[model samples]
Target: MPRIPLKYMLLPLGMALSACDKGLEEINRNPNASESVSPEFLLSSVLINTAYDYQREAYWEEPASAGRYITLVRNEDNDKFDWGPRGWDSYYARLSANREMMEIAGTMNQPEYIAVGKVLEAFNFAYITDLYGDIPYSEALLSKNEGIVHPRYDRQQDIYPALLNTLKEANNELSLLSRTVDATADPMYKGDALKWRKLANSLRLRMLLRISKNYAPAFSVMQEILNEPLKYPVFENNEDNAEIGYPGDIGVNSWPGGPLANAFAEFDKRKPSKEIVDALAERDDPRMEVWIAPVDDPNGGRMYMDDYVGVPNAIPAPYDYNGGSPHISRLSPMFNSNSHPMLKASLMTYTELCFILAEAVQAGRVTVAGKTAESLYYEAIRSSMRYYNVEGVADIRDYYNLPGVQYDGTREQLITQKWIALFLKGPEGWFDHRRTGFPQFTLGPLAASAVIPKRFIFPDTERAYNEKQYQQALVQFGEDRAGTLMWYLK
Candidate 1:
């Protein structure tokens, strides 16, 4: 028997069909060509691709641009605010594979496999909707077979509820799977269904909190999950974090700009923004040292400065790319180095969950058995510090004693910490800033508009190919500008 590899990830719609035909031809006598590809391989490939998407690419784009977390001395398009419609065409491509995995899993009668697919489906949809407010949800990714090429765009308001439902139903299905299968392909949790279940519940909580400000019904959903802990287990600690692990030696698995990919990064043009460095410095935050490298200031000659400094966001050209200013710092060696191949692509962390719980409690959404908002807030900070091995227990305690670090019972405090903790994780910090308006970012002199960007423009592909649907969606939203506030923000 010949071994057929069944790897499914982000394949373009046209390419996917062509690949399927090729696979079918190769595996003669197998009418169900897809059966030659195991659901395990499909799940693994999707997980790997998703990790690479978040950790390598989006780390330097929307998330960095939105939060003023990193300064782009290279392309600087996102910096100068020359905003244009961004595409989710690749997301649709991935979803096609996702839909295939669901079909294969269903045919095998594997509830866990089906649940995992739904979770990924919901996650990608949520990510796209979060960035581009209204998007094609119900009728997307069905062009080749279903022939629904021009799918209607769904409102974010409607999309969020559907995503939440998908997650809820997925978690229920995951718990019902009794047979334990080898999950070596699962990089996030090693194919542990329980951990995935936790992630599902935690993600549901995250989505609910995201819309709770605008959608009151979300509060009820939050209450239902909080009311049942066993049914909806959340991240208990850093161990339960859903991060993609890297091999450190593998070219594909290492950090994007690290030493292994030196050609791609040339000592990295990306640096921490002044907003974050200054904030962390003021709080005497230890995480700063772990995050950034001292500037290689070329003042008459090259020399390293012990202090951390960063470039201001959205500044004009004639900028310093070669460390001309003493105030510009490079990224930390841990991130930029090739040695720490174990650097994870963080999807979600216990620290984030604690912060979410902290916020939920402040808003009277949920309550821990004996913990107060302050307790959870402090734990959240400690969990972040511990996760990164930034500070010792004593050092963490001392740092919390700083005037700004203590829990002030304000939502601003929770939001601020969460923003700092979410560096390079992709888009969540930006999303938080847009929704809460905390850890305030200033529009630089070169800003395209006076306001900070709220939502990403729908991709030009939609306007060009799916013109009617795109036009209807644009008209419903009023404008295609980056500064337009999304529904959730409103």
Candidate 2:
């Protein structure tokens, strides 16, 4: 369990080009490739490769640019608020792999592989829809026989319900699995069907809770999970966390930015944002120390008021803060160094589930959850501290005494704390900030507009390749601008 073999992990995690190779043959399905590879083997490849991409792109890159935890000292386009184009093209590649896995599983009559494919496909589509709003879903991954080269977009309103059902179906199948792949094939849960079932339900909870504002059925689902927690099987502790382990020996699996990306390098221009530093400092949260290192002033001492001084977001290059140059605090060694190869790529965690429950309670969506919102909020805080390897329960307890940190049974309180806990994990913090509008962020000095971006622009390829469908979607969503609101956001 400690050292997953290289077969389970990978040097270049997403090196498999079967999907691309098949596509080049002018069809989605390749008879030769499908016959050569077992569905169980393809399942392993899709799971690891998708997890690796999620860790690199979604976990580190997207959230870093989103201005929640880290800020760029280079002060380029993303920092300046001219958010770049984000098409689902790369994600579609993963989805293509997933569809092939499911198809193969069906032909082979391996229910376990089929169930795993459903779960992974659900995971990818949820991420895709969340980021892009309406996207090609029902008709996607059908370009081979259906001749759906330009599939129409599925509204977020329609997509969530379908995704929830898909997750539910996957959970049912996983629970009934009498046999599964080898432990190596299931690196995340080591072929534990129960754990896989838990992850499926937990992810369903996450999706339901996210769209609960517009979708009222979420309350009943939450209540069902609460009334039968054992039956539902959500993440109970850090042990059930959906994290990917890195081998640290290879380029793809190694930490994002590698060894020299540590605090020692001159060109390592990333720093924690001042917003996060001030928030953690205000509550005397010990995780602040775990996140970043103190800056070394030229006078041979740390001249900062706070131990770590974060760079301001969206500021122009050569930006000055507090009359000092941009020698702001760098990320902690634990986060950036290659030495910590086992650095868990967090997909979801027990802490996040707790906060979701806390928010649901605060919203009065579910009254029979046993524990109140306040109690779950505290548990969420404690779990986050422990997950980050923060020492001393007393420090966490002391944080609770602070007016800013105390649970006030308010949505603001729940989301603000949840936002803090989600720091540097992924775009969840930024996404929650958008949904609840809590933990309000200040616009960087070079903001693109008065308001923050809502959604990323559709990629140029979509416009060029799928112009008819792409234009139709743009008109439906009301002009694919950053300011345009998605259905969920509305």
Candidate 3:
């Protein structure tokens, strides 16, 4: 009965414990899988996915067609506005990741990540509400925490204010300069808290201007932000634009229609719409060279005032329009490349901010001390030229002097330029068209819908699975069709 070693004495007990149910449960867990993920890890994934998805949506046919920027010559369903119930699965998936990131950041006491998360959340939700009208907001992405599988659809009117408040909260949190964010995790601003703050306020201004028509207080809140510059900073120049560049890593990371990712025919089918091509060509805008390619006349039999020609949207047999593909302008050759400095995924730009401010001033919403609508209008156009890297190629002043390009002090003039500046940025073009009715887009003879669709139909899956809530939501919408106007529009 000599003293036994402690290890040997516990060996039998340890073996017995391992064989028991409690120890077996622990032993069976996967060694490779993580029980938790860091906020930085989630931030990286969220940024990449959000940017990639948004860029693809912006550059692709759907929004571009609706915006009258480009038209598809083949598979022209979207061009015809033959939209069905469009699902928002990808938007919600990104939102779920963002929610998880924000939660983890809160537990870790990282206010900066939480602030960034708020901005991202607002951006995603804004797109949803803007596109589809009433959407699951307050109760969304809460399946794990509260098991709310069938979240109620929040009215667009209600959702807008909440989004504005969220951005305000983010701006306040980001003002705490002491807190830091991982630069590598942030692709848009690279851990620039001030830039994040700018984006929050800038986006707030955008939303406020959007709802100013219906919401009485929107302009007042917008005035408050503009009046307090330091407390609520906004994008001052192109340097502060919230945009992300593609790594051109081929496969998934490359530009959507980049030569490496898509076949030649796929890229060739998307011809610049006559609406945008004529707009650019008329003003001798240098951006046309950056955005549109000159049409090809191999036989030299076609006489053209400008080398560029565009296909009309919503028309039958668009592929054969303007003497087929050979005689119509395709997108600029630079677009076909895997990546270009000029082609980055834009969340928002100072160019857009300039136009927003101009519109606000024109509409008597807010006023700056030394600026007028005309001045901001000119700045907007100049910024667009610089953003497209065409400023050096041609003087902006000359283009501005052109008859139609000059500042006419009309809302139409202001928004039409904003529309041109917003090309391929996101759904902003379509959103603006829906909101302002600028550029006066006309439906073609062969258009499917008589009226320009205001919102997307609710996804069919919601009807199938979330029947009760879905039915309740339909009462507010009246009909689950694209022609139905959302609260914002109403």
Error of 2 at 28 (Å): 23
User: What TM-score, to 2 decimals, does candidate 1 have?
Assistant: 0.90
In candidate 2 the C-alpha lDDT for residue 350 amounts to: 89
lDDT tens string, model 1, 159-229?
99999999988889888888533467677787788898899999998999999878888777777887788
The TM-scores of all predictions, comma-separated, are 0.90, 0.89, 0.93
Candidate with the greatest lDDT versus the true structure:
3
* lDDT of candidates 1 onward, in order: 0.76, 0.73, 0.83
Worst 10 residues of 1 by lDDT: 1-10
For candidate 3, write residues 10-30 as lDDT tens digits.
243334334347677588756
Local accuracy of candidate 2 as per-residue lDDT tens digits, 73-169: 6635665558767766668877776687677678778888888888889998998887788888999888965888988988889999998998889
Give the Cα error of residue 115 in candidate 3, in Å: 1.2
Backbone clashes in candidate 2 total 0
Residue 173 local lDDT, model 1: 84
For model 3, the superposed segments whose C-alpha errors exceed 4 Å read 1-35, 298-305
Report how far off residue 424 is in candidate 3 (Å). 0.6
